[model samples]
Target: MQTASRRFDLSVQYACNKEGLPSRPQFRGWARAALEGGGQVTIRLVEAEEGQELNREYRGKDYATNVLSFPYDTEPRVFGDLVICPDVVAREAAEQGKSLEAHYAHLVVHGMLHLQGWDHEEDDSAEAMEQREREILASLGYPDPYA
Candidate 1:
C-alpha cells in the first residue's frame, strides 16, 4: 500500500487518431485522484480495431469496450496499464448524455480503482465500488456517472 505522499509515475500513449482526446495533464489528474499509494500507470488510447483486439485477446470479448485495466502489481507500489477506446467512450457518452471529459474522468478513476484491487463481480461489491466512484467523481466536480 502507498503512504500519505501517494506519488505516482504516469505515462499517456495515444494510439488512436481521435481529434478530441483528453490531455496528458487531465489523465494525470484523474489518475492521481484515485491513487491509494505510489504507482506507475500507463494510459493508452487506441482505435476501435486495436481496442477490439485487446478486448478479445484479454477479456475474450469480441467488441471494443470503453476501458480496460491491466494491473501488474499492487504491493509496495502499484504498476498497471489502462487501455481506453476513445471511439467507444465517445459513443457511450453520447448514448449516456454525458460530456466526453466527464466520461473519461469516470473511466480513469474506475480503472485506477481496479488497479488497487477493487472488484465489481458481485452485487454487494459492485454497489460499494459504484459508491466509491460517485464519491471520487463528486470530489472532482463531476456528476454521478451512474445517474
Candidate 2:
C-alpha cells in the first residue's frame, strides 16, 4: 500500500532477457492514461517462470498468461502493482501480429483499469472492460486487441 500524487511511478525487472522490455516512459504513459487523474504504480516485468509461479499461487492457473494486477489502495492517490511477463507478452505479440510495445501498453492499461475497480468476470462486465480497454489502446495508437 503505497501512495503518490498524479504521477506514474514504475519499477521494472527481468527474470530473463529474451524479449526487450518496454521503457519507463512507455509504461508511465500507458498507466497514466488508465489512472484517469494519474497515480503511482509499480510495473514489474518478469520471465515466464516467475509469472507462472505467481499465476499459479494466486490465481490457480498452471500457466502464465500476460499481466497480473495487484491493487493496494484507491481512496487517496491510487496505488497498485502490475506484474508483466515478457516471455508471454512477446509470444502473444508475435502470434497476434502486434508490436511488443503495443502489447505492453495494452496490458499496462488493462492492469491499471483493474486496479481501479474494473473486472471481466461476467459477459456484460467483460464487454464493458474490453471496450474501455479498446478505447484506451486506440488512444495509445494500438489496434483493437480483440479484432
Candidate 3:
C-alpha cells in the first residue's frame, strides 16, 4: 500500500469581521491530517458576502456556506484554496452543541478532503467520508462529529 504523504504549504487570510481566529499552524495540522499528498493550500476566512459570492458562482448556491474548497488538479501538488465562513461555523457549532474550535477543525479537514476529491453526494460515500473524518479528528483529540 502507498503511504500517505505529509507535505503541504498552508496559508490563512482573514477577511471577516471576527477577530482572533485560529492560527495557520492549526489549519495546517488539520489539512495534513485530511489529505494524502505533498502540496500547498491557502485557507481564507472571509465574510458572508465573499463566501456567498463564491458559493453562488461555483456551486450555484446563493448563501454563504461554512466551508468551500477549490482544488488544483495540476502536477507539483499545489492544492487550491479553502474558504471558510466563521459566522456560519459559529452558528453551526451552536446548533450542533459543539465547541467552536472543534467545529472549525472539522470544517477545515472537511474542506481539505474536498480538495482531495472526496465527496458525499451519496449515502455510502458520505458515510465513508465522514468515518474518515471522524478517525482523523479523533486522532487530533476531537470527539466524533457525527456522534
Candidate 4:
C-alpha cells in the first residue's frame, strides 16, 4: 500500500504523572490511515486535570475524556489537533478489558476521523463513522474496538 505524504505534529503534554505510553510513531500510523495528502495535525497527550479543564472549557463537560478533537478552520487537507488523556485511556482500557495499545489505536483513529469531519451525533452518522474506524483499525492489526 502507498502511504500518504502527510505531516503530523504530536505534542505530549503531561499534566499528570505517567510514563511509557505509546510514542508519536504509533499515533502517526493511525493519523495516516484516516487522512490523506500532505498536511499537519497536533496530538497532545495530556493528563486528567488538563483534559478535564479543556473538556469543561470547550465541550461543557466536567470530566476528562479519552480523546478530544479540535479541528482547525483551514484547508481540508490540513486537519487539526487531538488531545488525548492517557490516564483516562488506561482506566477505560482496564475497565473495558482491552489492551492499552489497542485502545490507544482506536482512540487515535476516532479522533482523526473527527478531524476528517466525521461525527457520531446521530445513529446513522455514528454507524458510518464507526465503520470507517473499524476498517482503519483492522488495517493496523487491531480488532473491532466497539465490539
The candidate that wins on lDDT is: 1
Where is the poorest 10-residue window by lDDT in model 2? 1-10
Predicted candidate 4 versus true structure: per-residue lDDT over 95-121, tens digit per residue:
999999999999988988888788999
Clashes of 3: 0
TM-score of 1: 0.95
Residue 35, candidate 3: C-alpha displacement in angstroms: 2.2
CA lDDT, candidate 3, residue 83: 95
Candidate 1 on 28-130: residue-level lDDT in tens?
A: 9999888887899999999999999999999999999999999999987789999999999999999999999999999999999999999999999999999
Instruction: List, residue by residue over 27-71, the lDDT tens digit for candidate 3.
Output: 888888886767778899998899999999999999999999898
In model 3, which range of ten residues has the least summed lDDT?
1-10
TM-score of each prediction: 0.95, 0.89, 0.91, 0.88
Model 4 scores a TM of 0.88
Q: Is candidate 1 or candidate 4 better by lDDT?
A: 1
Q: Best-fitting candidate, measured by TM-score?
A: 1
Cα RMSD of all models vs. native, in order, equals: 2.2, 3.0, 3.1, 2.7
The parts of candidate 4 lying over 4 Å away from their true place are 1-18, 74-76
Runs with alpha carbons beyond 4 Å of true place in candidate 3: 1-6, 74-78
Q: List ranges where model 1 is wrong by over 4 Å.
A: 1-5
* lDDT of all predictions: 0.93, 0.83, 0.86, 0.83
